[model samples]
Target: MLTPTVVSNSTVRRSSRTPAANARTSTRCSNCAMRHLCMPQGLTVDELPKLEALICNARSVRRGDFVYRAGDPFENLFVARSGSLKTVMAHRDGREQVTALRLAGDPLGLDGISTGMHTASAVALEDSSVCIIPYPALKHMCRETGAMQDRLHRLMSEQIIRESSQMMVLGSLSADERVAAFLLDVSERNGQRGYSHAEFNLRMTREDMGSYLGMTLETVSRTLSRFQKRGLIDAQGKLIRIIDLESLRRL
Candidate 1:
């Protein structure tokens, strides 16, 4: 019942103030830049159109907008078609935690699958766009397509692995080690997306980083300064450059 705008590739660059119901596009999944990451593999030429037909819509989310709030109905799974997003969970006592950072090519809304409602809120980190895959339709397709079913299973398994790794980072790593691993993880993800892994802009603020890394804001700032002094990194405001990759890894 959620009625976001159906956008094509050309319709994605509208003003941030544009209402979601006002825009439209004809872009197809076959031509999407993120197909390599979001699409199932080994589909025949004839089968490609069926997937494209199901994924004809996308929605743009302006920075700081909530893509979907916690407790919202789980109607669609989203792939980050462009830009970044962060998933956050709110405590009953009013505290919030950054649960995960999602970049382009990453999937969102899986958290809702278990309960038929979202457990956390997804917010855009920048002016981002998401390709919407209606879950009921996708579930139906998966029932008929072996490749699609396999891809869905693999995506779910990868989410489990990521959650396990986050637990490991929080439970065992020191503050310095935690920060190092965070940077390395971001670098690797950027590399995977064909960007320069050695340097990239961090869209999140220091406080958000602290929330995600389980460090105090002061501690996060101090650690970054220490890394700069040690020649482990060069950070200018939001831009970060990993100067000593091997040394950072050794941490």
Candidate 2:
């Protein structure tokens, strides 16, 4: 029912992952730019190398690649190193809904922890890479290390908070307001990653955005067009420039 936990923009995100999963050493947690957004956020210098060793390696994903499908065994926790991902929940009738749009540094595959089976599937939105954190190792680290344990708890709390916020966006906001909210969400996420707050490209498609916002594709396009005409935003295809951040926020 909720869109997802936005991982947002990442720094040092491109540097990060793997050896045990047949992945080579691409980057380590101690040196990753996106470490702030993932498990390495609170670990001390001495603790970083220990955490890094828990990851066997990184994996490469092309656009449209499935990171994991629903019902897959929950084994590893994935962190996006580059590019973006979307977590989707499919229905019985072959329809699916976008549950989350994951940016660089977002952790994927955590939902499987409760049942030991993935509740949703993840797909890469672009040419991307992910650090595959071995679950057993991660759990061991959590038990033995206070920093890892605290970060794990914090990440879980973050997931709850984001879902709650998305519920509010869906429950009370008007169509225009919803679109405004969506834009603001993306902008804020980008800013958090140290990217330009006022300008960025949208990775999700119009249909995807509509699905996430619970609006029609036409409504999503129309609302964006209206925003452009009103000087609230300037859009050329997927690239967007927020011209009136205050007004958008006020909505």
Candidate 3:
């Protein structure tokens, strides 16, 4: 399971942006790291310049900023350039359930496509920058370009696969198994984003973890303690070190 860390006040900072010196001119498009990820896989040089014009670099969000809330009109697809984000849904009874935790290089707000409104709230878990791809422009591109259509299909397919995995986790696994599976999943995703797979910081709280795993906060705590006692993981407050990855996988 992921452990929550109490970050010091000094680590938090507000999102800020300053005007670019060459704001009036179009910039070169070859250097963008998210080019292939945000757009189609095989965009031609002729198409890139137009795509660049539609994209705007935005300020980084601090750790508690809401990117967008549930019920907000969908405007853009946010591609995380750095740090992490948590997507949550709230119940009528006032309980919040964490739906997904996104890392750098993941796309946010895709769920808005079906309803034309955000289905969940997205909040930054750390200082993060997101490339805003306006939805109208993207829709136009997808209709006009075959490559964009293929990319959108691939993205939707990926979402389906993830949702299927989540259903299996929630419906079939025990509390301890769920926690173990979640940590391993997070570790693998973190590794994909160029961080250490087995060792990295966890930003979500125990309550949030419990919500995601469909368990009470106390059950979450008990499971973590049991894992620690069995030498599967070491927890010192929020800092957790995985000691038995194979055992965790077995659970």
TM-score of each: 0.90, 0.89, 0.83
Q: How accurate is candidate 1 locally (lDDT)?
A: 0.84
Model 3, span 143-235: residue lDDT tens: 877787788788888878987899999999989889999899988876665667767778888888898889999999999999999999887
Model 2: lDDT to the true structure: 0.80
Worst 10 residues of 3 by lDDT: 7-16
Q: Model-by-model lDDT, in order?
A: 0.84, 0.80, 0.75
lDDT (Cα, tens digit) per residue for candidate 2, span 74-102: 77788888888888999899888888889
Encode model 1's per-residue lDDT on 137-177: one tens digit a residue: 89999998899999999999988999899999999999999
Any runs in candidate 2 off by more than 4 Å, and if so which? 1-23
Off by over 4 Å in 1: 1-23
For candidate 2, the 10 contiguous residues with the lowest summed lDDT are 4-13
Error of 1 at 184 (Å): 0.4
Q: After superposition, how far is residue 47 of candidate 1 from its true place, in Å?
A: 1.6
